[model samples]
Target: MLQQVSFPLRTECPPGACVCERERLLAEPDADLRPLRLTRMEEQKLIDRIEGIASYEELKRLQDRIRTNLGVELKITPSPNEVRTLRGIVILLEDRPGLCKKVRQSIPAAVRKALERHPEITYAILDANDLFGM
Candidate 1:
């Protein structure tokens, strides 16, 4: 007979620290789940990419690149007023399933192009959100 399995959220680790408890559980003979972990350098790269951006136009360019290269519908909604700071480019995209994979696949190239197109852009951040009220 098949049994239902549930994983618990670990609260002991610090806010951004990586956890591998799920992996440990999966290693069990009867466990039915898999866990994923990213190396420290990989995590740092993600933080740098998201935090290094500097302008809305750069964000738009990245979004356009993703749409063109990945065939993903990425919409960027910039704030009405422009605030110039080192905060970089921040964008909100509809969080449909599988969209993240497309964004991930396209980002490296898109970022490279954005850098070449706009020297002012230092970083870009793409955040996903649920658009459907469901």
Candidate 2:
């Protein structure tokens, strides 16, 4: 009589040679994905900046600036369901595969903070894999 054991396959590709999305995502530091905690003044300034946004181009510019300054990616758009109001905005924290555990865990708090500070933004959603949807 003989006994045999099976082994699970490696899910991750080797470093430097990985071409998969997960590998690329894992390469980025979690710190970059996580938004910095700002002071009350800084938070107010950020909200003020967002509050005065009058056009899509301006919003896009702010998004670029945030990405450049904070290394945190954000997408802003008009709320699909709420149309007749100027303040009906949706803030989406862009999502992708292979985000580190720390970054993934921080997303909900990030969304909450975003919503709490800006009444202009009606919804803050996590795109792609929707943890909040669960």
Worst 10 residues of 2 by lDDT: 1-10
Whose TM-score is greatest here? Answer: 2
* Top of the candidates by lDDT: 2
> What is candidate 2's CA lDDT for residue 6?
39
Question: Which regions of candidate 2 are displaced past 4 Å?
Answer: 1-34, 77-90, 94-134
lDDT of each: 0.40, 0.45
- List pairs with backbone clashes in candidate 2: none
Compute each candidate's TM-score over C-alphas.
Answer: 0.27, 0.37
Total clashes in model 1, counting residue pairs 3 or more apart in sequence or in different chains: 5
lDDT of 2 at 34: 22
User: Compared with the true structure, what per-residue lDDT tens digits does model 1 show for residues 1-134?
Assistant: 33234533222234334333443443465642311222234434544553455675646664565455334444443234543432333333444322333333344444444444554443232222222225
lDDT for 43 (candidate 2) = 47
